[model samples]
Target: MVAAALAICLRQRGLNVGVMKPVETGVGERGSTLSDAEYLRAAGGAVDPVDAIGPYRLAAPLAPLAAARQAGTVIEMDRILTAYERLAAGHTLMVVEGIGGGLVPIGHHFNVRDLIARLGLPTVVVGRATLGGVNHALLTVEALRQRRIAILGIVLNHTAIPSGPSGKGPDAIATRQGDSTVELVKELSGVPVLGPLRHEPMLAQAWEAGLGKVAAEDAIRTLADLIMQDVP
Candidate 1:
């Protein structure tokens, strides 16, 4: 979803963009069955082929190491780096969404942070702007810093906020005034907040009406603009 959103956002700005999911699992059709590469192809107007975009396709929905272990396959770190290079070649910017959280294991000997460090890309954390979000986002930042990864910024994704009382909806409303994501982010410090994302009506409506493609491009473009604002 992040990849698709980013693609739509960047495409709107008329920039060529690519996405890399070094390890993917539990994909089916109806978009759910789709591989990360396929999602990029559908959401990213000018996407590379699936094989060229994503080189590792695991079979389960668990951690890559666990999944690979179950399948009796090895998750190669060098292969991931090579795949990333293949997807990144000739592109001004590439959005690489790691599987699971920042600490999730990718191979027997490495995790997401290792990938980030090896890639040497400025890191941005995409998080839910909800109750526990501050904790999760902060911990993520701290962990990355501990690993010596350059922390870029935090993008609190409002789209993933829970709606009920269990969620941060009440808090977000009280603070954000039901307007922008910026208000919800003033609660944190350290990293630059970048901006908040309002749920795009066109996107929801398109998905609900079974016409996601109608607004997919526009949404991708909008997100791309937001991402560009923070690029150094």
Candidate 2:
């Protein structure tokens, strides 16, 4: 969700947002629940075909390289770029969600960082808002920098509720962890940091509807404004 919510926020701002996952693993066949790409496309209000939204759907719940190999396929950066071009053709902006992390291998030698460099689009790194967020977020920023990829900012998303010892109130440990993660990442990231967005349990059950609930939050709106600043 941070990605899906960002897409919705962009759409709400009147940007014709095109979303892509490019590669998705752990997909169930013909399920009631939508895949990540589907949820993103729906949230972004993109009319692009699902094929364009996600060119590779792997069955195994593994990293891209391993999943593609298990599926007897190789993820071609060119293929993904082609699909991206198709989606970007009509939309004013595109939101391409990265799988795993920047160092994740997609093919024999190419990684997500390579793909991002090839796409030539600025990125927004998303990391967990719980403990260890600082390490993950900083590693990603440095990894992308190694490829000279433009990073717009960082977003620390709250994927789980950090319950305190009492495990009662919403603000228990969640507030402290969120605040610490956000501040640490911001101070050290060398880029803007947004969110640690409130945990929305409904997101897991209802992707689109759950995102609709927080699409207008201060962080999402601030991130959208930051993105729009680069819109020439």
Candidate 3:
């Protein structure tokens, strides 16, 4: 969702942006199977084919390698690179979304970290803004830093609304936890916290509607601009 929203925001600024999700898993049986790639295409107004946007679409909802093995295929890194080069050449910028987490396996000898290193693109780590978020974010930052991957920043996305008394909305505890997660991630990772998007069910609804730039919220646009600021 963050990837799609960011792509839309970048396009709104009149930049010729493209989107890619090199490997996708957990595909559904009906309707827009390659959901993430589709969303990105809509948001960025990309004209690339689905194969270019997502070179590998696995049926199983598992890690890339496992999914590929289950489907009796192997992930071809060269193909992904070729597709990416094509998209990069056609656009001023390309938003490439990574699957799962940094350590996820894309092939037998390669992982998401290796792929990022190969592409030489800075990363924006998206994580949940909730209890225990700080630990997860810091671990991800450390892993990326270990590989010397340039990290653009961190985005703490609120995936769910915190329920309060009478279940009205986020309670004080949830708010404090979210705030602390953002601060600690920044202080520990030495990476800027670009956004702590407040929980909004409407964003999901918008994504379901069309996943276009028109569905992106103002906060998403601000986050997108911040990402561009860090780009060379």
* Backbone N/Cα/C clashes per model: 14, 0, 0
Write one digit per residue (lDDT tens) for candidate 1, span 50-149: 8767787766767788888877999898988887887778576787877777899988888988899999887777776655666777788889989888
lDDT of each: 0.67, 0.85, 0.81
Of candidate 1, the 10-residue stretch with the lowest lDDT total is: 207-216
Can you tell me which runs of candidate 3 are displaced by over 4 Å?
29-34, 208-219, 230-232
| Candidate 1, superposed: residue stretches over 4 Å from native | 29-32, 159-187, 199-232
Models ranked on TM-score: 2, 3, 1
- Please state the error at residue 132 of candidate 3 in Å: 1.8
Per-candidate TM vs. native?
0.75, 0.92, 0.89
Over 94-153, each residue of candidate 3 has an lDDT whose tens digit, in order, gives 999999999999998899998999999989898988889998899999999999999878
Which is superior by TM-score, 1 or 2?
Answer: 2
TM-score of 3: 0.89
